[model samples]
Target: MQREDNFTFLTEEPIPKVIGTMAVPTIISMLISNLYNIVDTYFVGQIDTQATAAVGIVFSLMFFIQAFSFFFGNGSGNYISRQLGARNRESAEQMASTALGYTLIFSIVLVVLGLLFLDEISVILGSTPTILPYTRQYLGFSLLGTPFLMCTLCMNNQMRFQGYARYSMYGIIVGALLNCMLDPLFIFGLDMGIRGAAIATVIGQIVGFAVMFRMSLHKDIIHYTPRNFSHRWLFVKEIIAGGTPSISRQGLASIATIALNVSASQFGDAAIAAMSIVNRIVMFIFSVIIGLGQGYQPMCGFSYGARHYERVKAGFWFCVKVGTAFLLFWSVVLFAFSDRAIGLFRNDVDVISIGIPALRYQLLSFPFWSFMIMANMMMQTCRKTLQANILAASRQGLFFIPLILVLPHCFGLLGVEICQACSDFVSLLVTIPIVFSAFREMHV
Candidate 1:
């Protein structure tokens, strides 16, 4: 009965209301998930600047983990939503189980490979001699939690795509809150330093995975059974089509972070630390818009599959307006308090000085992200894989990679400061035409 009602609610609810209902839980979940980093950065900062920088250095690995999780989650979730929209429960169940099966396999591989290459991976992630020990200590423990973290994130996306975002939020909130609570205990109370922080994170992820896995067994939600798992070419094609945009977006983000770190390393540890703080702050702000887009994704997938093109367009425009307004307000707030915001994570004078300009520059481009992100989400959900993949790659891959490489050489430290802002502007321009073309094709 609830499942039937969900279909009715998704299809028949007013656009704004439907999106609002969905967006709240998703926004909360995104915020909590980001707190894993924000909280870790804060607690670890208490030890010393190098410890904080170590967390930042290992952040790219976190991004790499998320890239694959999103690949499987978004791919399977999008397909599941479309199949559910078409009233095909069997197909949806199969995709869900298949995604879960592959997620576990891939995550185990990551853990083994990551642990085996721990030292090399640390160097590649831009860990300096001063930060290397802390990096290895923190990263090794984090790798152990890879399976739990990846599986939890994968299940979270699948649940949200099924319109069970509230249940998803419960699991994430529990984990994030546990991490927050344990951070002080492990980092300061136990005197374990950075190692404690890593332990807390792994424990939190393990618990979160347990909660979400239990939720997955609920009758209304699709259960992941062995019988439903498959490696058929048809399932693989669908997953790839649905998931590739996320891979491009998130995978490129990891690459972009590594590039930023390498460029900043030339200027010394202060530069790396400052830029790392700025990136975390920006990502926290950006997560709001991403959550808004996630809320709209299921609506887009269902409506598009059901041929309700008008609802898809309505949800897209609504999200863009709301998301842009939110960013506009926060950008101004952060710009005014740039020093304090950066200082909140690390109070070093060098870190604060370098972070202020970079944070402000990034904010200048924040308002434009709403349209760019929403458009990409819309295209991906509608199965415009090529356009979606192009848009996904534009910000971090196509534009940012080139600018980060060239600008720092030409302008020194200032180039690192403004590179992301420049990339955001160019990505927005590229997104405009692709989105327009997408809408015209839909006759919207």
Candidate 2:
């Protein structure tokens, strides 16, 4: 809670400078983390389109995993940053410790259950007969690392929330580099194929978790430890309240992903493969937006708690402008290069045929998405949990799920292709009024 170090910088430094400094590291980390998936996809894509489709099927489950990580991680980290801003160091420490402890315990349960129900889970994830074996193989090994992945994710969020984005970057960069290096080796060098990709993924995640854990103990301003952990109902409620938006966001995204896969499956494996590739490419660019929003989150949390109302307003508007520019730049490029980009993954006429329109359609809505993401991140960090959850679930849950379900039935293949774009555009409409209203309240 001391204002002598990072806390001072977070609370008192020039808004642009502090946010820029925080954002760069976080942006790098997001790239590396997303790169993990890209590396896996690139390597696995070399195996076969079926391999790529298998990964697509498993992708929904990963969303399910991340939902929990963010639920607790964002929950605890958001609360911790606010507490630190208010100079309540003890509560922050307690929440940090308890969050990690709870995450570890629940992650073990997830891994065990995941392994036990591995086959059924694969089927539930929308794996086909041809893709089922690979899906099971990849998920079996990958699921074992759930604990580490959750820990790494939780720690990374905590580090960023506390303004230690550099430390977070280190852990992620190390793991991502390791994943990239090991991917070809294990998949091709050792001839393990999809299983190799999964093995490499687990090792990379564990190392990343280890690096973050060591840094959490030594390098970070706020640390998680056993002595500080307490299983209090109040803290649990707070974490769920603060993190509900993320859980809703990610959880609904998972459901939407599964729906997308199932809907696309009605067409063929090419549809699944095409949609997956577009998603990864788009998310790669979206990582920058997420990183920017993360950079803005701490400022929102710190400023809101410290009662620097105007700083919160300035930071929100600042990030929205920056996010829009970044997104718009990527949007134009991706829309223009949609064909070539989809071809990068699987050079098939069928895949490219399905992918091109989907990619361009999704990119069409990218500009408007920046506002919604920035607003959602700020609301959550500022502890406007109800509004945050509504906005969070709006894109994927309220808009996306129904759109994907109905659109395919209405327009068949084209419907599936345009579902996400439709969702994003609709979300923008819903978000603008809510966010601007929140902004209006800040002035009062």
RMSD in angstroms, all models? 0.9, 1.3
RMSD value for candidate 2: 1.3
Which ten contiguous residues of candidate 2 have the minimum total lDDT?
1-10
Which residue pairs come into collision in candidate 1?
none
lDDT tens readout by residue for model 2, 26-70: 999989998878888888999999899988788788878988998
Model 1 bad stretches (over 4 Å): none
Residue-level lDDT tens digits of model 1 in 1-444: 998888888888998888988989999999999999999999998889889989999999899899899999999999999999999989999999999899999999999999999999999999999989999999999999999988898899999999988887877888899999999999999999999999999999999999989888888999888999998988899889999999899999999999999899998898898988998899998988999999999888888888888888888999999999999999999999999999999999999999999999999999999999999899888889999999999999999999999999999999999999999999998999998898888853
Q: Model 1 misses residue 126 by how many Å?
A: 0.5
Off by over 4 Å in 2: 1-3
Q: List TM-score per model, in order.
A: 0.99, 0.98
Cα error, residue 291 of model 1, in Å, equals 0.7
Model 2, residue 389: C-alpha shift (Å): 0.5
- Model 2: how far residue 325 lies from native, Å: 0.9
What's the lDDT for candidate 1? 0.92
Quote the lDDT for 189 in model 1.
95
